[model samples]
Target: MDKHLIDDIKHVSLSLFNKNFFGVYHGSISARVSASGFIINSKDTILDEVTEESLVRLDCQKRDYRWSMANADVHIHEHIYET
Candidate 1:
């Protein structure tokens, strides 16, 4: 994982948190990490307080038990990143 990428996400999370957006909804935040892979917040992550463990890296649409920690919105993020 890239340190700068994680920092960028954390920065955005704080900015968005003040807007009462993500902080209120507790929604997932994501960033594309590769052509077919992206990192997103885990299902229960607090956006404003994201840590490395709070992020989940997904490279495929297929889900396994390992993906249980991924966000429920992972598919939505994947679709957006696809294009």
Candidate 2:
């Protein structure tokens, strides 16, 4: 993830946490990197305190992740990849 974007996520996470919009470890953030790829915050890391290195790279076609797997809708990513 880009440094600025990661910083933004941290700020947003802190805001959301302060507002009680999501529990400490109940929420996550994701951003599209390309049609077939994206970077998602790690599964166990608290969003508010997540760092750039804590981000995980996911490839829709390969169903692979650098850190951990997520149960998100694979079809959505596939559709984007196809498009």
- Best candidate (score: lDDT): 1
Question: What is the TM-score of candidate 2?
Answer: 0.71
Query: Model 1, range 1-83, lDDT digits (tens) per residue?
Result: 89999999988988888887886437889998888788899988877788888898887655666478888887788789874
- Residue 6 lDDT (model 1): 91
lDDT of 2 at 14: 80
| Model 1 pairs in collision | none
**Would you give me the overall lDDT of model 1?**
0.82
lDDT of 2 at 21: 79
lDDT of 2 at 71: 20
Alpha carbon deviation, residue 31, candidate 2 (Å): 0.6
Q: Rate the local accuracy (lDDT) of all candidates.
A: 0.82, 0.65
In order of appearance, the predictions have TM-scores of: 0.86, 0.71
RMSD of 1: 1.8
Clashing pairs in 2: none
